[model samples]
Target chain A: MTATTSEPGLRPVQKSRYKRRSKGRGNFEMWSWVFMRGSGVLLLFLVFGHLFVNLMLGQGIHAIDFAFVAGKWSNPFWQVWDMLMLWLAELHGFNGVRTIINDYTEKDSTRWVLKTLLVVSALVVLVLGTLVIFTFDPCVDPGSTLSQCK
Target chain B: MTATVEENTEAKPGAVPTFEVTLRIERYNPEVDDAPHFEDYRVTVHGTDRVLDALHQIKWDQDGSLSFRRSCAHGVCGSDAMRINGKNRLACKTLVKDVNPGKPITVEPIKGLPVEKDLIVDMEPFFQAYRDVMPFLVTTGNEPTRERLQSQEDRERFDDTTKCILCAACTTSCPVFWNDGQYFGPQAIVGAHRFIFDSRDDGAAQRLEILNDKEGVWRCRTTFNCTDACPRGIQVTKAIQEVKRALLTNKF
Candidate 1:
């Protein structure tokens, strides 16, 4: 049959032998792209706020001793801030690495393995971080010099 | 080099060894056939002959019915791009000696495109995608009396994407594009990148917004097929990555 289009000015559609493959179920990739930007913006503030408080405030980098950290963690506000920073940065970093892995890895098993390690590592950091932030008691150490601990 | 040429010419005399190169070209006549089929034609070619030259010999000497597109006979013009041995390449650029000289070379229209008769594909969809991205420069305000000045760094930023000749090789090679026709292939993305990163162009935000759709830049899985298929050796994947980064940070 001669290549012919029923509609004028339109090219004839040659049926491809290949089957149509969907990227994924629902709008995962779309949300993934949006998350990168949204999380990235939030991360900028969280990260910078963390650095400014730790490095540039008061005695600057020299003031960041064990007592300084203990003093900050004594307040619930700092606990929440640290919590947000940990979660957002970890998830953002995870997503970024996932994208890189997807782009560079050639084999399916390699991608799966790398991604599994990524998610596992992120979860480990998240769980340990959340635990330390919420459950830490500086008073437990008898030799602690922190006024807030006393 | 001159002595070598003279000695070779003297040794060969009037006879230059020529061998038969069979072209199993895909043939489809929309006027009559419902499906496509391969038709083989044997053409004599020398070592330096390109696939386009072989096609010319076939069309001129063997059968006038053979149909293909060609211009400039070099890599320019972006015409006569076809699949030679399952890979998209410019027919004018592909030397026969490099692509299976002893066996029949399979010449077919590029994939993910509608075949229009013998080796030509319907390029309407490809061009439509290119047009959809608004490939031209979009600037606001009155036209400046002088040319829009751009820094060397700014020019270098998007220098790679500017080499696109509108060849459908990159687009047709993409598996995502083949699976889904609606997705703007790397060709269109590269075109948008050409303008999106242009320092003088005020339309980067607009173009980025246009490309932020569901079927837009996000659809690219970074298979690197487009980069591999590009005839100009343009960094197609790098351009796409730059576009993606722009979308994320709102900066090109």
Candidate 2:
């Protein structure tokens, strides 16, 4: 039988075969990790408050209608609250799904395609949601019976 | 007296009973076999026998071709670590009875690293990760004439992580490490934790910077597999969390 041994001074596994996209570029991952924790805590409050106000305070889920939403948006406090919730929840969820994709996807092409679709969808939702909040017209409906429409 | 002596030679009343255990070992001979497969060997062993003993029986009596790495069969050498009953464990440390000897015990090489032969893997990658973390004390300034002094509390700070044997059990059990070979794995993080929390080490910043890379501690999903697989019970997941917290707070 022939005796054999591994070569001397083999390269570190991380450096040898696997391709790393980020070149140790400043603490982006650190910040991403920090963002996950921070955004998670913030989302708890924002999400719970949104649910409490929308579903529990005064009128419950049945009270939620088009006019009810318009009335809430007409107020600056509620608009800012909804906008914060929208952005934070969307971005927080986006970053989360992005992390999942990064963890699971093996091929670079698969990661790129998934992340691209994620970014595009997130951008569309954020832009559309923000515009809807800012430029909301309660009087747009001709059959509206709200006091603001008069 | 003659009858008692013969009976004593036959079977002692309190002596441990022996049973036959079938070990289903994953075998791969790169020279011959294209893919890995399981081969069973039945061995009669005492209740006190370890998995290593069963392996030795198979190697010596049944199949001379069975190959495995082992040293200090009592488990200190960190060799002979493999998947026993689907869990990462040192064969020398795992008692056959503890692994449910009633059924077949599965012995396979730890995952993630390339399998070199039956129950042996290319540990270079695992060691490479360990080395990248700088698993040694880094001190600045001239060597002191006297040994550096540390308080009891300071010593206890990183006491848990100092028990790492580098068996690759914790790293192999990690799903993240299994999927992404580039991620620095839990063993590397535990190695960094060993020195990062050391009161005397001046290399915390450099090591922390190394771990702060994209493939660093950020990839840890807090699955606790490393913690569970740790033979030394080093609280692997907690150490990783502490390192992550240190990265955020810049304090150890």
Candidate 3:
């Protein structure tokens, strides 16, 4: 009896069918990973500061009325700080959730849908948050009794 | 052929204490079965027998149709990696008693690979990933007059990743690999790490570039499943992290 030959396996030079696409998005994933770490550290300080000032300093949580926000945003430093916090927090959260979506969603179409929804929601929050931080009016209420409103 | 433990004990009075171990193995015959199913077999095994031994007993005495792979009957060959009692382990390395022989031990093929038979998976994909990383050292320039030398400290940088035996245990245990087979799993990253951090290898840039793909090192979520599943105790996740760090710093 004669022995039959089997097909040869992949050679060292041959790429696997499962290999990631060669035309990669360059350093996008690496930069995203770095962004997560960098933004995470910055978020720690920004979030803690925001919390300490709003919930601990002055009259504490009771002092966080609309007038307080109006007074804070009226200053350029507070405006810049709040804007940075809003942008960093939104992008950080969006990137983190995007990663989760990519990890869990196996189908490309499904990932596309979820990611589209994620981007849309993130955009809405970011735009609204930025708008609220910058365009907030202290005297929007006509009958306001606060000195700043007067 | 299916003898009770008491019968076996009675047959050999002074023999080592033997117990009946029921191995519930997930079996699939592509030629016959439409889907994979579990099949149980009772084998009388000695106190010191490994899971591989019980499998052999079933194949030799009770069911000749049972198929599995085993080489060296020790941990070095890395050919017998399977899911033993819900965890990825080498059957030859896992003792029957160590895995609670009182309950039926469940043995199944490793995940994320095409199961070619009962306990054998088509390891081509795993090997492909390994080969994709260029596991061997690559050198450029003229050959050294003597073998390239390195300090002990430099050698130890990647020593932890050198223990990998390409078992596929670590890769198969990964949830990311399970969800996306395209992702170059932990084993490939370890394979790359073995050479990437090597002071002598000039292939770090190429291998790191390959791993920078979307489905490459970035796909790893630091789940640590690979580290826990490694039969050789290699720090699989740490190697992956080092690779990621190397990519970030452009310094291996």
Candidate 4:
């Protein structure tokens, strides 16, 4: 060890050593970050709107029942709203949890297992929720007393 | 005089015990060596002695070639931040006895920064990020005749982030920063937060817009490594979270 002498790899930092390509399929991480903020903002509206309509609307909490849900889903407008909410909320939440797993899980296998479970579970919920929202039928039974059926 | 000095040197009841320890320091001389290697030094130190003291002893007594940085010899200047036993810490703040007493303490340059020589790393990139955040207060008003008065509540809002010392410990410890050097690391975000939350500052919007870039606060993965490595005990992860929330809420 000497006090000071020659230039090894120690050159002036002209440009950043960080080599991030501006364009590629590798832009997934960048898009993921963008999606978090975008979906987060969208979710605030969708979630609050869903809440306002479901819990605090004309009938309020007291009016909620199986038939009340059937009536809302009967409308095409509600179907799209619910579908958008389901997709955005699930993907947003899944990405958030995936980030968390990446941060905490040091073991490669543990991260792989946890992320796999998360993606599978989120897909399951998204597929099921979408089916329920779009394919829902209030008149499944001909003798049903629901107002939606009548 | 020698007899009196010997008598005074005797340990008192509450005096901490001294122990012989080894310091395994990573040595890299770009002039002389192609690759880095470790040099071990045996030094007898009191339990209260900091790791910096051991380095000083080695430089003074053992090998004059040994190179490291120290200024205040206290934690305030943040000059001697390095990896001690696989963690970033201020050498002056870490007591030898506290970090694995009997084992050899390993000292190396902080990770994610290019080593110029020995323990000193090039801090230009780190400071560049700091500069990008605009760490100064940016109020638009004319110079006040009197001091700009802040209410107690408002002052306290950004107090935690105000303790930053420009030490790259938190920034270098972050895996995100380690992996992607382009990302404005935690230290920069903490600096931005200092101004972003200050009630008297008018630059919050501009700073927030700057941070909204792809490699800004969103790059933080909340590893808690920054929080853990902070010598000032600043809640770095919490500050990052607050900034993230601000990005969406558009408020403090």
**DockQ winner:** 2
Q: Tens digit of lDDT per residue, candidate 3, span B1-252?
A: 222345455666687777888999988887897667889998878877889999999999988988898888889989999988778999999888788877888898887777778898888878988998899989999999998999999999999998888889999888877765788899999999999999999999999999998888988888888889999999888899999988988932
| lDDT tens digits, residue span A1-150, model 4 | 001122234332334465332322233565687788899999999999999988998979988888888988988899899999999999999998987776556456998999999999999999999999988888889999986677
Local accuracy of candidate 4 as per-residue lDDT tens digits, B128-193: 888887989899959899989999999999999999998899998887666437678889999999
Model 1 ranges off by over 4 Å: A1-30, A34-150, B1-16
Assess each prediction's global lDDT (C-alpha) against the native.
0.79, 0.84, 0.84, 0.81
Residue B134, model 3: Cα distance from true site in angstroms: 1.2
> Which residue runs does candidate 2 get wrong by more than 4 Å?
A1-21, B1-10
Clashing pairs in 2: none
Q: Quality of candidate 4's docking, in CAPRI categories?
A: incorrect
Give all candidate RMSDs, comma-separated. 10.7, 6.6, 6.9, 9.7
Q: Per-residue lDDT of B1-252 in model 1, one digit per residue for the tens?
A: 011122244456676545677899877788887677778998878767889999999999988988988877788899989888888899999988788867788887887677777778778878877887788888999999998998999999899999998878898888766643667789999999999989888898877877776667887877788888999999898898888888778632
Per-model TM against the reference? 0.64, 0.91, 0.90, 0.67
Question: Between prediction 1 and prediction 4, which has the larger lDDT?
Answer: 4
Off by over 4 Å in 3: A1-19, B1-15
Ranked candidates, highest TM-score first: 2, 3, 4, 1
Clashes per candidate (backbone, < 3 Å): 9, 0, 0, 0
Could you report the DockQ of all the candidates, in the order they appear?
Answer: 0.09, 0.27, 0.25, 0.09
lDDT of 2 by residue, B1-252 (tens): 001012232467778667778999988887997777889999888777899999999999999999999999987789888988788899999888888877888898887777888888888878888898899999999999999999999999999999999999998888777666888889999999999999999999999888899899989888888888888889999999999888889832
CA error at residue B30 for candidate 4, angstroms: 1.0
Q: Candidate 1 chain B, which ten residues in sequence have the lowest lDDT sum?
A: B1-10
